[model samples]
Target: MQTEKITSLQVAQRAGVSQSAVSRVFTPGASASAKTVAKVKKAATELGYRPNMMARAMITGKSRIIGLVVAYLDNQFYPLALERLSNALQAQGYHILVFTSSNAQDRIAEVISDLLDYQVDGIITASVGMTNDLTARCETAGIPVVMFNRGQDDAAVGSVTSANVAGGRKVAEFFVSCGHKRIAHIAGWAGSSTGRDRARGFAEGLAAAGMKPLAVIDGHYDRSIAAQVTRDLMARSDPPDAIFVGNDHMAFAVLDTLRHELGLRVPQDVAVIGYDDVPLAAWPAFSLSTVRQPLNRMVDATLDMLLAQIAQGEIAPRRIEFDGPLITRGTTLTPKGPKQ
Candidate 1:
């Protein structure tokens, strides 16, 4: 009453090849001659035979699946990074299972546990944090974990990040070179390493220039909160001549607050510089001056480390940092020399 499922054996018989040859043709990273592959593929096409990925994985002891956990997508950068990672992994014969977690610790833990249950070959966490217990569990499960655009104090955890501190320092130097005397900072949440490192570098840069910021407030990487902070800063009689926001997402809100609500002209009444040169920063509406995080390079490094650990059956955690350039736009003054 029901149709029978086609298998590799039937495909091999039709193609005049052994079952093992058909398997080699279908399996990822398996060796097979071009003629054999073509014959097997033709037979598979004719018979409508699709290889069972799960069964193949069982034979290899590798799911060849990566778990991607991300926190927050309001920032355009994260989505772009996710796309790059997905495409890159797919090309390397791997697929990804994505899980979204709020910045909440418990939610992230739950998602990590779910990923582990699926027996993914490795995990990549973007803008998300993991607890000691969860990290331990992952290590015990022999799963390699790589943090993308995030960092932890634990030496056992691997991470890839743009040079946040250096980028921040560059922003400060740019502000100083532009002759902005009263500078303020709307920082990302201090709890995270990216945020802390950026703040530290900005301060150090300012000190190097023999200047100090008017104020440094936490924006928590939120648009509305950044807007509110911008309002409060502008309300002061001695407001900053320039403001450095942690990232371009918040910088947009800060720009809007300055232009619409406060009736201020960018780079005239106040200058704004932000980190993460996201695509929106180049939009005609918001030509924001910001630091460019090399997303492609970062993604490449992340994949390289993740795959290497997976292949080696152990993770000797390493931190990879890439230098990012600052892109100048309409929102900030041109430096004395050639513009970046």
Candidate 2:
């Protein structure tokens, strides 16, 4: 007969101790006598035994894990935020179990349920479409959930985001101050709160300055649509002389088409400004002017809010909104700021 593999029970038996004694010895920072720990380690080394986290959580009532759900990693900002969150959470002795999807909203409840099954201590959501049922499930699970860069219509949920509305208004004023008339807007995906807020702000800014865009088209926050909408705007009989793209990714497409396809001059024929001021916006080829969301600061706020809840183990929900800055560059007329 083949020799039976050693188990924790066998380790306890060999060490002449209770099963729970063997368990404490294997659990990090769990109270155990030095002699018992030494005995358990020796038996475990012989048995190639490892402690099971699910079993340990049953004993201790704490599972040191965070479930991170991000829907739009296709957007560079979400990936950047995810990386920062991973690093930040790891420093706090918590690890992320990532769950990603394009339209994660539909399956969000299912995903949260599965994460609960794994006994994660908390959750951070970057999915815009997260449903009310999922939010309710998270509430019932009694685990802290922080919505990152997105918010629910439900005021009860905790979240952190940039001041998109104000930023939109600020950019609109900047465009008018540059004396550009007949402006147009290449909007973000109307589905997201960020997009909606920015669009609303831009409109308010335009109205405040007594300046209205000649045309406003929904870019749907896609690069191809941004370029195509831009082309449509340019091809019109009374095309806009300036364009404010909802985000830098779409703004880049606007620059390419304007310069290469229609051969328009920047800030001369059609002044182009974008939002979110991603790293590539400063690229030598594009050098696009845009609004900045202070992504790192927002990430810090997300980490701070979530970690505070994790440490406190209970608290009222909180929200943080970071201020955005306008970054001037070659594409749009420079404001009274330091040149790039």
Candidate 3:
């Protein structure tokens, strides 16, 4: 037997209210009196009536869905950020539709096209790059795009990221303060702005102190690669006394390699520092010294930029960056008192 769908008209009749009143009750941001809301909800529950979001979207031309595209979630930082983004959007009566994309340009374009087909109100790209053509298509479709935890040269798109450069500099300063002469870096993927910025800042800081890195190698944001890089660095005639890794994900691998494979003592033979103070970094096993990316504030800023565009219709793009504090832990030597 086929069951027919219950319409809002039936609910309105049962609640002794107009169809529009029933609509206003169900629609987000729609105004309805308390009495009307109670009656409509009671009738809806009794009749098993639910508002059709698709029909509402067709009428209002707003799907109330935000498309979130991320390149990878293997990194602990991204999963945490994604959860926060989803929760914040849900609280605003908006739903998130997640999509994964490869770093390849074609793959990213294909993903954006699918998002456009869904008529998503806005798109947030995390750890992914957007091409100019895709950006133009989104602009033509009147869909706003925001970059989360990634940056691009496109001025048309808004972006929110931690002050990666400053974070990297802090790591260098801490290492120099500890009197480590030979310092090296296992950098993040050079293809990413976050990676490049951090490397640049670290170099600048070292240069300011009249010291240069012993070696700077691109880890490509891969654990295996970072492990191999650690081996290669250790094989050098004079190994670095301190190493700064791009992010905590790779840093964890470095720590494992140093301790288990190379029999090195942290902060004794070699000191390690990383970016993104992920939860695992705090564990006694790792106790990694790192720069903390303000995830909550970054998420808040991303939502603010995205919502403003959705409401205002094509406002000026904004680039927001937050500075993170360097957290010292077991992996790095603690300053005796204060720097001279």
Candidate 4:
């Protein structure tokens, strides 16, 4: 819809003040007298003259925009997180400029430079494969960059992720305690930080109980890949009595593979578990046992960390990892005694 153009000069003329006064009133932290501010408001109201944040950004060379990089929007978790991040940033009077990468190191560098060219106040990389150089560049530019979901050990980069290793370990401990002797894994993409940490932790947890898995396969965080991986693992010389899939998304395919394709009953022939207890995990069709990452708390922490860094010009890099809870459900066999 076409709207009326409201110029600052017109506002100043109506308020009987200089144009600079109007400009100062609109700019954040700009000095303007209370009387002038009130006068500009009155004039703006009369003429429906709204200030343009984008236009002001051009003059200050500060876009107040965040660069949000996502590897694949296909994953329901990412799309859901994207929506929440966008809404949260908007509420904070900032906007997001989205970049969809193929999780490539080269492409990520290019995308980050472009976003920097636009003078974004901060950058958030949700992609699993963002390179070190890209993050270093953002650090040099004095723009805050936060790694969410996937993170690095470098303290120079602020990261917010679920305690992947701990969560994975919890799943393993639960399985072993419930008397699952023959366990297998449909692991996440081994290339990503999330996948590796979970894998390591799961193995560690199993070692504590002195029970090793029958087999483990890399799922690559893809449904088709996960299904194929599950098939191979389960078809081994001695298939596992229980299985742990990387996330809820891949777990669904594993379930289908076992029940429909392989004709195996869950928890009887093969107990199953997954991470990221997404909405569908609770659905009757899936009813999957999984680990729950406190989504709201994670989101809040990420936003708060980014905004603070942006406001302070720069911040000491830090990693903030939160724990996830193991949720027991229908896919696994509950122990006979009191809950382990």
Candidate models: Cα lDDT each: 0.92, 0.82, 0.94, 0.86
Candidate 3 lDDT trough over 10 residues, lowest sum: 331-340
Best by TM-score: 3
Question: Which wins on lDDT, candidate 2 or candidate 3?
Answer: 3
**Backbone clashes, each candidate:** 0, 0, 0, 0
lDDT of candidate 1 over 1-340, digit per residue (tens): 8778899999999999999999889777889999999999999999999988887777787888999999889999999999999999999989999999987888988998999888899999998887888899899999999999989988778999999999999999999988889999999888778888899899999999999889999999999999999999999999999999999999999999999998999989999999999999999899999999999999999999999999997658899999999999999987666668
**What's each prediction's TM-score?**
0.96, 0.83, 0.97, 0.88
Tell me, by lDDT, which candidate is best.
Answer: 3
Across residues 121-224, which tens digit of lDDT does each residue of candidate 2 receive? Answer: 88888845567777778778777788887776875578898898998888888988887778888888888887888888999999998877787778877899
Show where candidate 2 strays beyond 4 Å: 1-51, 335-340
Model 2 TM-score, all chains together: 0.83
What TM-score does candidate 3 reach?
0.97
Which residue pairs collide in model 3, if any? none
